[model samples]
Target: MAPTTERASIFDPDALERVRRELRLHPQQLRVVRNAYFKTFASEQETLALFPAPERVHLDPLPLHQRLDSTLDGASKLLFRTSSGLLTEAVVLRPRSGRSSLCVSSQVGCAAACRFCATGTMGIARGLSVPEVLGQVVAAGQLLAREQRRLRNVVFMGMGEPFHNEANVSEAVARLIDPSYFNLSPGKVMVSSVGVTDGMLRFGERFPRVGLALSLHSVRPDVREQLIPLAKRYPLDELRKTVRELNVMQGRPVMLEYLMLAGLTDTDEDLRALLAWTDGLDVHVNLIPYNPIDAAPELVGSSPEVCRVFAAALKEHGRKTTVRRSLGRDIEAACGQLVKAHTLSERRAPRSDTSSA
Candidate 1:
């Protein structure tokens, strides 16, 4: 009896028939041939680069808003959309000097739920995708360049939890750092997290050269948790430990973001806790006054006197600190304010129609 001959299928049916005919394979051998050909073709496809050809569909060269208008027919002005699905909806604030920066969203709505933050009230929706995350930078870059400006920096203090969305956020960072794409230096980017230890650790490993900011509103555990619910899950002690590890790993000082709320979490005790937690660590404290929101009327911005006292205490402890002046206040560009207004306006519209009818 003759031994069975192994046959393989060529991926192209016509090619397979030609080869089979040329080889004059037996009927059984043809079945074996077909299978082998498909297996090899599938393997080759897997290794091939899948990104769309750069020339076929170019991202419009026009500015961000213009592209947006062209895409959406100028209906929706780029305001804060819910941060969960899109991660964050942002307005590309056209810079006065043509120098712009992106206010990127870390999470959809913040889980922090800080007393003064509208985003917090909305709660965490979802994390943004890598492309969605990078899209914000691309949008800002287009808008800025239209006005003869360029993006100088990127702030990840927008609507979402950056640390929570670490994977996508890191991917987006990788894209930004790519020269063919945004080509942004790691130094020009800043990521703010509400002190999630696991996320922080991973972020440090993924982006060792990027800037990190801890949203350290109140160093006291109880007060901190009250201001940010996530604080309950990750206490100050744990957070401090994480920050120390991150600092050592990155070999750079981390930024401490302290939001001063009037009469709340701004006492001498708060200052002492902050100093203690940050003691012997390389860090810079950025004091940001509470951006007022209607959702929490009780929360108010800290006065200059209170901010000064805290700054002095931090200085006394030999910790570096700087006060952040509020920008875009008039345009509702302050953190959470734009989203809050959008939410309020949306709610009022239905009520107004009902009353009119």
Candidate 2:
């Protein structure tokens, strides 16, 4: 008899087959477990019961480190600890109109180094495995299910830029849309990137129907580079060209994400530059309010009055616009804010405090 191979993640390609061969279970048993665990978010016992080799399987690739719910909004942020002890975040936004969305993270920390974002300050952390990314979805879906709600949308606007971890993000989206797994509609899933031209173009060519958003926080090349250092590599002209190509590839308007900041990107010249950049492209503008991070004290959020004016200016220019309402502000709703705080707190904690809960 040959020695058996050690099992891998249940999300892995041959994980189920190996388990079926080892446990001598019927194919239907494995399918049931996958569907129950991945699709239906069944309980641990219920999912395990569907497998003869339950003990041999790796059910979860991510462990729930902490769960935080916003006292001010219907937003819940989940911090998941990877096997390496590093943490990533996912946010569940339950809006008033009832269509809930999950924001998933793609990396531990970000390499983008956007001046305003907390995660970017942490520097280049490791990319998350596909299982780790998908794990956030599973955990969030289960949490929503318990509240008698369903997750309707998935957005890669959590921690690291989606295009930064292009391969893993692509694979995760594929699994999300696959009927055998999350079964999310392509239109309901949105991938946001900080203007990685090549990655954005490739994604458009592949998942044509899956929505894409360009975080075009500033249209001026210098300001954009100052805010998002990756912008220097991408530049404005090349990025706008890529966006045009994506528009043609998808046969739909792409999302243009503009952060409304007081002095950084919300000025008259900035608005004109944005409109000029968006000219002749099929795009929708999403005006995001600046969520001030202590890491970027130089940045200040635009007032509501200013945001309204900016939206009006874009709409005046015949562009479709939406001002996204801020949620979970009291809970530091900005991506990577809570995780940064928690990571710093843990690092500061005395090693002598070894009492395990």
Candidate 3:
């Protein structure tokens, strides 16, 4: 819990307004502070310099604890620490296309327990607050601003199942696209889910322009259940129906995220099932290469040739498909690999007590 005298989060406009009223500063002064902080993504010091009473405002509620840059690609993993010492991760992806993107987490850990996901192995600690979620964008945006590049996209594809934290995630999205806040285009924001049917419907209805991706790794009921334990609760048929509804609600093709596991989800039978399942649905298929993780030793990614062949087969069937370029493999920031190893190690370390006498 925050202390009584804790500074107000810059993400909370109400709190900032209250602070402004208390300080008796001109309204334009607060607007300048907001423009510098949210729009320009200025450094905390620089943003605070614009305000008369900097001591009363807190720029970042979640302080960045560590950052790891990938040696093989334009990807950087940022580890942030909450006030309670819990850790969450966000990834900055600078693909060759030059449209930089940020993947932010909604929870410290994940409860989905997907067999192949490292974060899923760690039971969820807690859902992030709205401020915590938006702070990631602020931090990442400032980092990109330093490099003279703006963050073009934000995806809820980092460490946790987004629908599980729907309320906070939804509130964060509201502020992200709100004209007076982050002011990003709704089309550039996406929330990926593991088939939370009700939440998906609600989210689609609320933010019709925002992209929604379903983690439909497998259409086979048994196989899907094995890969994603949450599948058992929301059956494949139900998920397909929800996707159809989302298509109509959003008036856009829903993204179906398919993970390619060699000999598991890449076989001829699996492809046929996928084709049959998506026969008439207006959806785009994204083929994601499986990133190897120690927790799931049996799951290996399909070969490049196999992925190409799979994509070719999809295109031949009139299905829109694109093989996603997996980034940050060397830094363990790729898909299914965002478990905070440092946080786990810290948890295992013995602590010493030095109480003042």
- Most lDDT-accurate candidate: 3
Can you write out model 3's per-residue Cα lDDT over 1-357, one digit (the tens) per residue? 223444667877788877777777898998898889888999889999998888989887468877888988889988887666777889999988889999999988889899988888876557888888998999899999999999999999988888889899999999889888889999999999999999999999999999999999999999999999999999999998999999899999999999999999999999999999998899999999988888889999999999999999999999999999888988888653544576677689863232110
Scored by CA lDDT, what does every candidate get?
A: 0.63, 0.86, 0.88
Tell me the TM-score of model 3: 0.94
Candidate 3 residue pairs that clash: none
Q: What's the alpha carbon RMSD for model 2?
A: 2.2
**Is candidate 1 or 2 superior in TM-score?**
2
lDDT of 1 by residue, 251-353 (tens): 9999999999876678877777777778888899999976678777777888988998888888887888898765555555556555555555655565222
The superposed Cα distance between candidate 2 and the true structure at residue 12, in angstroms, equals: 1.2
Candidate 1, superposed: residue stretches over 4 Å from native: 1-55, 58-77, 80-87, 91-99, 340-357
Better of 2 and 3 by lDDT: 3
lDDT value, candidate 2, whole model = 0.86
List clash counts for every candidate, in order: 14, 0, 0
Better of 1 and 3 by lDDT: 3
- Stretches of candidate 3 exceeding 4 Å from the true structure: 1-7, 335-338, 350-357
In model 3, how large is the Cα lDDT of residue 270?
Answer: 96
Give the candidates in order of TM-score, highest first: 2, 3, 1
The positional error of residue 357 in candidate 1, measured at the CA in angstroms, is 33
lDDT string for model 2 (1-357, tens) is 564766756787586677577667787877787788778887667788877666777777467887878988889888888767667899899999999999999998899888989998875477898989999998888888788998899999988988878999999999999988888899999999999899999999999999999999998888888999888788788988998899899999999988998988999999888888889999999999988898888899999999999999899999999999988888776779888876667667742322210
